[model samples]
Target chain A: MLSLLRPGSNPRRELEAAAIALLLSIAIGSLLMLAAGVSPGRVWFAMIERTAGDPYLLGQVLYKATGLALCGLAVALALDAGLFNIGVEGQLSAGVLACAVTGASLPESTPGILAIPLCLAAAAAAGAVVGASIGALRAMRGAHEVITSIMLNAIVAGVSLWIGNEVLFQGGTTRGNTIVEGAQLPLLPMSGSSVNAALVLALVVVAIVWFLRVRTTWGRTWIAVGQEPAAARAVGISVARVQTLVMAGSGALAGLAAANFVMGHKHAFEEGLGRGTGFLGISVALLGRSHPVGVLLAAVLLGLLSSGGLAVGDLVPKELMEMLQGVVVLSVAAAGPWVARRSVTVVPEVAA
Target chain B: MTTARLMRVASLALAACVLLCAGALFYGGSAYALERWITGGVALAVVGVACVVAGAFGSTAMRIAAVIVAAAAIAGAVLETATHSELFVAVASTAFGAQALKIAIPYALAAMGGAVTERAGVIDLALEAKLLFGAFTAAAVGYASGNVYVGVAGGVLAGMAVAALQLGLALRLTADQVIVGVALNLLALGGTRFLLQLIFHEGANSPPSPAFENTVLSNPIFWLAVAAAVLVPLAMLHTRWGLRLRAAGDRPEALVAVGASPSRARFAAGLVGGALAGAGGAQLSLSVGGFSADMSSGRGYIALAMVILSGWRPAWAAIACLGVGGAEALEIQLQVTGSGVPRELAPLLPYVLTLIVIIIAGGKGSAAPRSLGRVS
Candidate 1:
């Protein structure tokens, strides 16, 4: 089970395959750009120059990466337990709502230190509740997590809309009131950038997750249950309990992503906060091969593409970037089994 | 505990919950509530209890009887909640029925597509993508050429294209079906949105295209969908081809012993299913007279759910689709009638109902295809 949890191939080989996939996706994207009557080279050059050369643009990448990394880690955690957490979108929505509500309710004079942690904790708990419900449904009702999670997404959308209209909406406005100043994370001392403390916090999360997964018995047991439930059961592990626990942990991680938008940037919840970021996390997990370190790198790469896509919207439509991301994920999925087969044949005699 | 006993207990619990909730609604001190509606709720609860008793103590016939009574009870509840006029109830139900038929056309077609493909063992999670691509191409072609037939053909071909991608990835290369399906969905969304923007210069909707606006009885696609639904089951039960398809999914080695390739059989099934789903999509866009990115919404997923809820059978799948459509139509009617249910929560009824039905059906006991998600 442990062996199955870890990839058999060397890290170098996996890295090489990832790089190739990225380049191929870019190539396909360029062809589409050409067909659309745009010059890919000019667009690529502009995107790179804007994102890498300018500090403000770089800050934007970091800001986006903070959210993506947390969500990516959330997905990786679920994947470690052999579960697909498609409800991350719904979970994140609930989390941001909880964070905003709690932040807004706090006294104005509350210390930033206490207020920030309280808001984050509230978001995590809210997300965990949502996640645990789906887990319970899967365990007790014989429901597929995929279908239930998707259903929860629709339910969350309706609930969020209702809450926004009835409870959160300020008088004559469409959005909730802003959080108190004490609850907001302090921004980095940089000119022309809104990058806040979330980036540092995201990195800390990544380190902690990595340690838990590699250096703890609990993580091993979770992975064991995921890889082979029947064997785990035979060995006296309660598969249901592990699944529920991992799912809650996964939800909490995804909920923490709300901090990037609610506390670090917008300081209030509204419709479309970090829209599509949840789905993007799935792709990042796949690209990173569901490893903590790999998820971080993939999130950063996607952050660059997204921020650059926005910067170069004039030269080529930003929709192209979206298409490219989809193309990359598809190409990787299509190639994964074949690559795994080849690597297995090459390695020869690895114990099953 | 044995699964059957577990299911029986769950069904009993559901019945008890229904009765308890109904009793609370009827007897609770609401000053302005109607007596007739409360009586109707109690009647529904009685039928639910009868079903639970049959499930616990009766034979298969009794269990089926219980299911029928439960279904009727649901219909009664909907009628009571959505309409108040006893004199006009008949008239209102006719209108609601027509709306349900209209809403159900796409679902029936899509669910049929799902049922057939899943029976052959290649998971069709890309149904959503196929629907989106089909809708877009159908609208675009119809608008450009001024012929509905061309549009329909475009839709069919577009669906086949998406199926071909699934076939290559899932069958040929043996990629994870779920992952490939998700990727295809994302691709379809992005690709369609990009093209819609590029050609229409609009972010949301396309120009109005020609459409079939005939009454339900006169609509050709509606009949086509119904015929497909009826014939698929007959074909599955009586035909040699049907046997081979089932064999391919349930016991591919037996199929291999007979000198037939399971992969080829699955490929053919996927193609036919894709075409049907595409027709559903084409009909959707035509009904609305234009294409919108969010038009299909989650109908494809709902169709997938219907297949499971129906226990992998075609006729029952059709029934499930009608139920979902009715639920949706009732939601709309409730808003029109000022039934006082929170409007924001009304749209979620169909999805929540699907989840409940699946849970009651007891998960893996739904008689799924044996090798459904396995790679050959």
Candidate 2:
């Protein structure tokens, strides 16, 4: 027991231990499945086969990955700035509502070219307003962003429910008003899936964010604030301004994600459209270690799990997929400290 | 502080309250309007007063204020019911009485668990997972054994298992405790959901058990919970173990110097927290007679908030829980009455009030224990 208290474990050893832990978790999950009278091997096989079994299934996975990628980027940006914006769900919902409302309200005779930008702008604007409120509260009153963001999430949920149920709700139906054909996102031919041009838009935004973070003076200041707030303030950085901008940018990205889902696929705002994607973005960001390219990979991995889970519902229960996803997140998170500890030796002089 | 500044702040807060109330009233109309108004306003007032009392007279005063507010809210509800005034009755009964208790009890129990763990210097943000574990375990055991007692025991054991896992990571490996806690929660949630689907061929919700009974005035569980509320504080203040736990939290280095293992204290506290949270889950599943995926909802998070609002005192946390719980119950009641109040606003009343309270309290000098989220 006392041996367990010692620190300074080697990096190689930690990695091996993490690998062992992952294997052990899978073993335990298998045992659980066996106890419940299911074949663990069959479930695993089903999960793999369903994801890569067909081109159509593969397209769905990619489509889902696109949204996760954007949301993950949003989360990564905000988290790197030392902000925990739990209100991403709210921001995304509001964005969806805004895009749907704008799209639906557009005249059928309106030029399709103008309507597309208008819908995206409306979505971004909605998300920005919500995100800015959270930033302002943190910057001005010093409210804990976590708490405020959570509260804002609830508020946004209520507002979204109201909009879907009362205001923008399609009369005599449970769904929202459908967008005009002119406002509908153009889909790629022969894809069969509603995969649209927004995928390219999301990629463009990702590149822009990467460039801004790596190349701009503003990005450096933002990182400075995140790494050492007092030091940044002493150096004449406007912490509040940086925070506000980070939040707005995060919100706008989240909104764009929602727009991609609504205008591009569903063609209307729907209750529970955001589902838990907002919170899922956090997991993606963590798994990716806040790297843009890493986020893309993480998002794809998650998308595979989700789409595969749905596809194999006849063979393995969806709950099993959820369990695997949860295990993946847990293992990754648990490994973080061990990983950090190993890297600590390389930068012994700098305190993390 | 300048009078002008104080006045400005007060007016702004009041304006916020008025706007929220008006929003609810307008959206809901006269149907449950009174309930909406009281639910939103009274809950906010309770949080505001608790903050002020905590600031002025110390944490002990805050405890007293929380308890008094809870009791008063309940009494006000009963009185409203007695008077036959529609407005008062609607507000009091629906906003402050039975409904509020439901919301508060789960939160209070979770908060108490958090308080003990934090007071012992272990970070615990996995309360939600603990709750799910308890709920799932209790439901499963109850179904298998056909005994509520067995279910409760199973739930507590599940919580203990989570605590043990957390301890292994936090103490043995010296992992980032918060992240570990989060991982544990996710694991528990997913694990429970999977097991439930596999075993019961259903989602997380469980069927009602015959052995379980609602904890009304005549029920033993009601009294047991009350006993727990009273005993936790007394034990914390008077017991040798409690002092050691506090010492471990406030200054683990000092404790270590004196030959005490901070890790041991933390482990013990974590176990106790698990037990409390487990009991809360049992109460929810067994007392309610059935389970749903959304049953726990965000109660665990609310409990964490209550721990902050109550300054880490068990008794105070209980009272605050009751207040919030009462507000929730009242919201449901108001909604049932079909008063003009919008159903959405009624459900949202407690959260909005909590937000307002946090805003009014401002960010300076929170009553949270200094040792919270800090591990040696």
Candidate 3:
């Protein structure tokens, strides 16, 4: 158990570190709930019960998890290439718009099989374009992708406002027209819940990503580039090309995540459809350690927390859950290094 | 020294003027029919291009001439606009300037904070968190104490605490600064929103706190912000402590060679930087009279851009803040005036401009701290 807690290159230590960080975050979260005059125990218990007991809430959690997992994968992909694409939020916005526009433009007679796929493809392409712009800026102009991505988020926000207001806005409303029936993803057989094919799609994407990450030549090169760009360049790998392509792929994942909303849940584009999903993806990726399995699990856990937070609104502010998410990410980052250092020293002492 | 380089710049300027003149001519038929000011602006822009071309020959006279012509072109545009609309002049001078100053304050403070921390080789992306937490603390304290000053102090301390978290996580534990910063920001947002709702039973905004009246001289926070902008640069450039911090950023091994601790210097710099950012946050909440959810509203990010634009110079960063503030002020003015430009597009000006500036100026030879964002 102690060896598990020791931070090392081994996956077991990483998992232990993550678990410890999560526990600490929960402790901090409980204290915060108590300060707010809510019984942390009651709130947490209710949160779990509501999410686990109710089929509808469970569906909602899965719905949220679908989008978050894809976004986590998106960020993880970029990180794999040594690129920080914080513009996942912006890319999601672009995808939403793309799906909305494509959905709106397509004929109502078009079959759902064709239309839904087209919308998803459009969204992914649009997001890839946006992500590629940031990558190109980083590669060609030497602009730091971090700051550029942040700026792009703001710009995308403005652009979305314009699109919602001027282009796609329904009469006298802040929302766009609902997509054609054929464009909507079919709901699953789950009773009274909006769980759709998107969840299955998310899992499929996760599997494909895991395969690509662990098996492909490009994947190996991407990992090599991330670890040591100069060494990769010395070995004749075009780092710039890898950065651009990985970032684009990352953006495509985020765009696909938008399908969980625009296609699965909302059936239309709205002003805040993918609100906070992009940033939440960052937290999910951190918590999951960017592994496909880890990201899937982290996404589901966060989705549960969000559902739970909303459920306990009468006792504790739902925002507390978000704070806990943030705390988990921070504590995990902090704890991993602390445990790693300790393990290093302890190992040296043992050898002596 | 190379004619080819000079010619390239000259040709670019010439192309720019030609495009501007053509645009003016094409659009001149409606509002600018026979408007000599439009013609004059175009003419002066042409003259500026000519002077730029001449200046490539390495003559100071030609360079000064180019600057004068460029200034005249700007004056011409202003003259045309001012002549066309009296409200534009009035708004541009008083309301716009005042609004710009208010917007600039927090940006300048945050940028100064960034400058200091970055100079000590730490990238504190948690300025957004610091500002948010500080604003919340100030609002809560100010509401409770009914004294804006005490509230401000509370805000500063809160900011310091947040900064200490960054220092510990990023420096002590050697975590990714960006991740830590992002986490801090999310935490601040969530924590403040939770607390606000819990305490006030409202999720949107804090109850109105003691606020400074709009009296220019009487508002202590405004003056304090200004003092910080001035003093921070002086402290950064002049003090022995400042020198150590600089070395820690650029040459930590050298500082260690001299028996000084780079980590301590960095820690101290982070604290001071956080304090300044906190002061800025105080200005934001105190001026508005309360904390609003997500009130920092990406200003911290803009301040980061301003730091890059200013090339790590504190004073210049403050000045850049004013320029960004002007863009924000213009965004508000466009909304109010119902300008011909799309309202949605108007709010995008500052962000788009930041991207442009960063793209153009962020390349090789830019003055980022040598070891900025490096792990010690």
Candidate 4:
């Protein structure tokens, strides 16, 4: 999507591109709903009414959004470095297992301050190991990160499944043993929903990402390397090191998503835990256009859509929300380039 | 006719007849020891041909080793066919061959389509979307119309429609092909379920409908797949359309030099490729009796992998599909027969093997189109 725009363009134009994409998806989604014999207005109203009207549902949305935001940040950061990290799903899977195992192994009387960070650190470290290995493959061996990441994802899935089936969940049940109680993130005041401190962490990360992108030299270095690798190399920047580091950073952020699931929601590593969030991160990053603020907003909007689909499930299939995300990304991608091209052509006329 | 010319014709006819008879007897069992003889004979011939093909690649030592392995496999298969023909017949029976064909056909078709799409410089990751749309439309239309052929037409058109969307975005709108492709696949999965709910009033599957009597014997789409597997690469090497398509992938500027539009050639490639892929989708539904939502099950992606692994050759992609199908079939057999590898791990063999092969082969003499994934 960044490729569709001018390098280092005004942020407002990028916002406009994202807005146009959203509006287009809304229009298409409404048409689909109408075709399904559902009243679009009522459906949307019900969706908003149930998802955001009730504190419980709103809390659920927030819980979902926390993970999506972290994942969005991961993908957005990688996108900024010109590395498409489709392996976020795999990284998150690794993190979830590691986090669960770490929490389970800690003494039963472990304190929150000690246990939580240790588990989270284990998650991030596991994820970084996966993320950096793929990074090294792309950096040193010149393999396309996309293919290697996908292969890595498949491997992670197989290994995780094997471990989960054999070692973690020894009983007939598919769910793993619970983490120490101290390691769990305290639930928010919302009615019985799993919203917790992870939401705060996600928001903090968003702000951090914003500050890094706008104010940090390292951030600029990655963007520079992304845009012009040879030029960066001419300036004595190590492109390989930067990419590998950025990818590892991306993987760690994705790993942070496990806190929301393991520490807040499930408190255990379950098979099929948080499935599809990694791919949804791609959608968020694309829809967000790789911006920190944009990613945060996109994550909330998508989380609302996911929860809202269930809210309005009786009127239309919840699957429509999934389709809507696809429509959103495709419209965004298609419109990005066309709008940019038009803007380019219009600039001369403006000068005249 | 001249005596020599007639003799040559007679010899050719005789060879064809023997091949057909052997293939029939190998799959369709016989009363006598003749079945065993035919099975062994076919096995040896297949292994011999494999050895010759393997000889085309690898160092001299590797080639020699592969040949020795091929010889051992051939001798083992023949001996097994003679005494315990159960193993050979299990793999080569009419039922098993049909199942493998069913498994391979859709993948082969999609892979061939992927070969054309990627070879023409468009990275087609949404082969799934096209195939899914094809399958759903074929099932829906075929059930509604009670006419299988018309349903197949609907599927083919559906595939082309999806192709046009991809091309419009990737080529005209200059969107990122991989992103568009991925988004389209997600949309296809969800959209098909949405449509299924709307049309069939169910999300899981559609009602069963009339289908082809025999895919191998009578299905037009099956023959089309066969033709695509055999003819696409030959056309790539020979035809004007083929040359222009290659140029579109390798050097779009060369087409401009010749006063031709590479975009046009690419569009042409998309049309042909989309239709074949769509037909595969139709075959999937029609052969299976109905469409299950998103039933292609990553076959389209695997087909794309095979396309890349085969270095963009349609024939090799089809062969790769066969290999994948064979592994899957063997995995099923292993579940029943039991094995050292966990039954759970058996299914991972094809995917893991493909990944390993790709890693080994990716760096050396990469044959991907020069301007691949670049929207010009």
Candidate 5:
């Protein structure tokens, strides 16, 4: 799952690949819908109508999108530097763990300005610690990030579950203590919708990432290291430092997803909170072509599919919706490159 | 420069951890310390001692003896810690070995399956997917038909189906192999859950099925794993097809020079690998006599890790899986013995051990196939 598409030769080629992939996924998805004896048109229509009809439901999609955008940016950030850090799952969880504990443990009288920033910082720091370890392993031991990521995922899952079960767990239930009232993010003006200021945070992050990638020397340095590490080194850039920073930066972005799950919505640490968001983020990043604007749009698109899956549960098996999503990812990963190859001149294989 | 420094720092950190555990053992002997650090602590200390002895002695036999002694020390330490009395004899009984072997069968098979596809230059990240698919098919088919062998066969086919999707997309369509595998994993996870509800009308699990007895002795799948462990490596080295498959992974150009299709070799290996993994999945559900959502858990990933640790050799991977299984069995034993370790943290044992072992033993650049994870 980690080594899918090495970044394509150019941004234009990647865009073409993603478009082609989307078309293929739709084509295959329709076939699957037909085979399953479900009406594709009805399913799509119902998914769209049900989700868009209710303000609460629409807000729920935006809430989900808030997390997805952060996570997608996390993955996309690492991809920018030519590294695959699949440990976003662990990083995100680490953030949630820390953020939840910090929020819940804070003094009840603390102001939102104080408590919120403290919790957010806790989340980011925890996630960055995990990410930095992966980076350090690569820099110091030449350990593959994928291998370390797998190990860390296991460790974090166990550690988080242990802490949840032992320390934070409330009696007779799975979840832990709720956050202090001051730490809670305010709900947006939408009537009775769970959407909160975190949506704004997500967008602000997208813009920040855009600015970083576009305007900063740090941005260009990482991309240089990613595209050609040896050449970047010859020009006095420390590839190791850039890679490590990229992983840490990626980790922090993933950690920031806790803003939606912990502060904005759940208000507590729950087991399996933001469970599959990290992996889903990969889909978003790919579909969005690793661009900030593209990721924001992709996150919203996925949020629709996710929320819509439940809306259409009566008409079709909700699991099929997930399968279709996976199909889209696979199709894009496969046919996107294939279509791009068809259009462009063949590049000679780089020597291993 | 970095590798040496890493080794020094790692070993030193491990050595410090051992010293801390020993100090805690004598002073307070907290259960928390024992649960998390003792096994790793003793294991690393033993390895360091063995390394020093071997280096000073400077003979192959001496080195072997040092390693043997270290192994014995680790086993003794664990046994002593697990059961502090004559209870040790009971824990070491035949039943314990049986339990460990039964647990190992699926992991071993899955890891070996990982070897087949990975050695052929295809990532088997979907091994987890195959495990779930295989288990679901085996249980559902076994329940519906009341035929154990048929259910196992069905599981194998399910595995092959996942493998086909992965290989076809990655090899034929020129999709990114990793992405295709990841997609398949997601599909397997969700599709199985959806199908469970659709077919069984229950989300929790399938109905009890006609399954083999829980013992590994009665399980045909166990023997298959054993056979693969013994034969797969030999086949990979000795057979013409195996040679071609290896060429596909390590040097596809060599296969091109010989005019044998690399993708065909990969496809064949993938199918066989899928079957072995599928059988492992069958054993999982059949032994339980039902299918549960996400029942394969993370065994597939553990198997994937085992592949890397074993240097992508099928038999070695299978052997490494036994250690993991043993860790699991030891945990169960400790819990039964009323050991004071936190029950919630018990699940961390095998993973923690794997991580420690990987850091100490793995991360070698030489072990991987030169052309692994490449498109021809």
Candidate 6:
């Protein structure tokens, strides 16, 4: 135990320990569930079957995945830029509100083509403003983006609540205004779930972001800034400018996610619509290692956990899935440094 | 040198008078606002004087003055704000005081726990998890045993278990502490909810605990808390363990050179922190007689803010917690009187005020601990 606590322990051993720890956490959770009279095997089977076996349920998972993917991509971008953009929750809320309000105000006779684009634009603009506020605060006043973003999220929640209650409340109800039909995103062909064109849009955005980050000069600048802001500055890069641009882009993606959720699925902004997605996005980014491909994979896994857990509620408590997800995130984070250290050791051994 | 000290004191005095006068003028523009304006002005004046005195003399005397001034200001402000001719006072007195106390005490305790842990060189961001675990275990065992004390003990034990688990990974496995902390919070939330649903056939909200009938407040516990608030700082500064802890935080290598184990110090600190936070959670359910899904209600986060505002000093944290608690109490009071302020704004007041405090403190660069957030 003392040796385990020492600083100079081998990285390979640490990774193995982390894997064991994760397995132990799962086993303990399962035992607790069993003690509560739940059949752990049945629960596990139900969760998997609900996610992959049924078409309708699978569609729900996909619908959730699309939103998570967009938000995950946003987080990935921000992480790559070394910005912890926790304000995605607020940005998403604002986007949903903007989409709903804009759609409600538009003429019923308006074409779906025009209305959809207009709503998307509105969401993007709102998100951009929020994202830029964080960037500007960081650049000009040295306020930490994490703190400002969190404060902004609270402010947004308050403002959204006020709007839902006071202004855009449909027919004097506390709920949000009903979105216009013309503004709703059209569903994909024969999908039982409300999977819409937004998935395609999200995919396009992901590709664009990936291309920019890996292929463009600006992307290289962002990577440079992320790695070492001081060194980037020494190399004549404008760190502040890059940070602002990356953050704005990140907010835009989150806003788009909100727009997709409201226009394609809910057709109305609900209180708590963000549903802890902002924080979950942090987990997704970390789990994905800030890579686009990794983000997509992580987002899908998270989506499966959420939708599958809900679908299998009769067999397993949904909270079990949440616990598992949290454990996975923790294990991954714990494993990161050890993995880095192990690679170092392996390279030296191979050279020898 | 004494002249220089006196000059510094006089300048600080002048600054305080100026700020108070300015605050009075700013808020006293309307006759209806005069009382609140004056109260706020005086409080600011007291704080300003305390700051200057601390700068001129030493932290020890400054801390004593802070406690006295804090108490006096709270009592005076509560009295004036509660009974002033303004209609807001009556509502504020009745409604805001109880509710805010209900919320603030738990947070203050959690923050004090954090203060202890951070001061001892361990990074503890799992306060929310600890709180949730305490609440969950207390509710479950309390319902089972039909004894609130047993529930409280169970909660503390649960918290210690979590601390031990986190320490195992953080200290032994060299896992990232923050990540583990966040995971622990999530696990507590999800695990508790799962158990609640499975066993009680209810959602996350458990049945109320067998409440302590308000006798605990009358018992020695309340006084003990107060005394602990006062003495912990002195103990921390003067005791050998305290010295080791501070050394570990400031310079872990130095502590190691002096034959102390940093990991051991951190483990002890983490356990103590967990226990304190657990007690705070126990106070919530066992004292209040009920449990809800979000019983902790972001107090864990508020405790984090308090740790920052208090600058890692336990006594200062207590003072900051009191101020926050007072503000919360005032907000509740205003709400009850049906003051002109919107109901939404009432709940938002503390958060907004804290944000402002953060901004101002951030401007001065004196709010947070210098060594905070670093691995070493």
Which predicted model would earn the best lDDT? Answer: 5
Compute DockQ for each candidate against the true complex.
0.45, 0.36, 0.39, 0.23, 0.52, 0.22
Please give, for residues B1-376, the per-residue lDDT of candidate 4 as tens digits: 7532342343234233433433442334446556556655665465444444433453333333443344344334433533443444565567766766667788889989988988888888888888999999999999999999999999999989999989888888889887888888878988888888888788789999778886465777778788888899988889988998899998988888889988888888887788878888998888887999878766676677677667777887777677666656655554454433354555654555444333323321357787788855
lDDT of 2 by residue, B1-376 (tens): 8532453355356544545654455445456566656655665565456445534453445544644553354334333433554545565443344445544666777778877876787766677777778877787788788887888887778777777777777767666555566566556666777776776777857767534443355444456568778887787788877877887777777777788887887888889888888777766777776555646656666676666566667777677677677667656666666645566656776666555444443332345555655552
Model 4 Cα lDDT, one tens digit per residue, A67-167: 99999889888888777788899999999989999998889999999999999899899888889877765665445566666667776787788788878
lDDT of 6 by residue, A1-352 (tens): 0112222235455446445444654576577668767887787677886667777777777777788887887777776767667688888887877877887788888898898899998888787778877775565334556556766777677767876775666675656766788888877753478777788887888788878888988888887777778999998988878888888888888888876688887787776775667666766665666667667777777777678778877776666776676666566655655554555544433210
**Model 6, stretches more than 4 Å misplaced?**
A1-35, A128-152, A172-174, A233-245, A346-352, B1-87, B91-102, B219-221, B363-371
TM-score of each: 0.91, 0.85, 0.88, 0.84, 0.91, 0.81
Q: Candidate 2: where is the Cα deviation over 4 Å?
A: A1-41, A136-148, A238-241, A343-352, B1-87, B90-99, B362-366
- CA lDDT, candidate 3, residue A226: 79
Q: Poorest 10 consecutive residues of model 2 chain A by lDDT?
A: A1-10
Interface RMSD for model 4 amounts to 10.0
Where's the lowest-lDDT run of ten residues in candidate 6 chain A?
A1-10
Model 3: how far residue B135 lies from native, Å: 1.4
Q: Clash totals for all models, in order?
A: 0, 20, 0, 0, 0, 7
Full ranking by DockQ: 5, 1, 3, 2, 4, 6
Clashing pairs in 3: none
List CA RMSD, all candidates.
3.8, 5.4, 5.5, 10.8, 3.7, 7.4
* True lDDT of residue A245, candidate 1: 86
TM-score of 1: 0.91
TM-score of 3: 0.88
Residue B146 displacement in candidate 6 (angstroms): 3.0
Judging by DockQ against the true structure, name the best candidate: 5
Candidate 3 local Cα displacement, residue A208, angstroms = 1.7
Interface RMSD of 3: 7.0
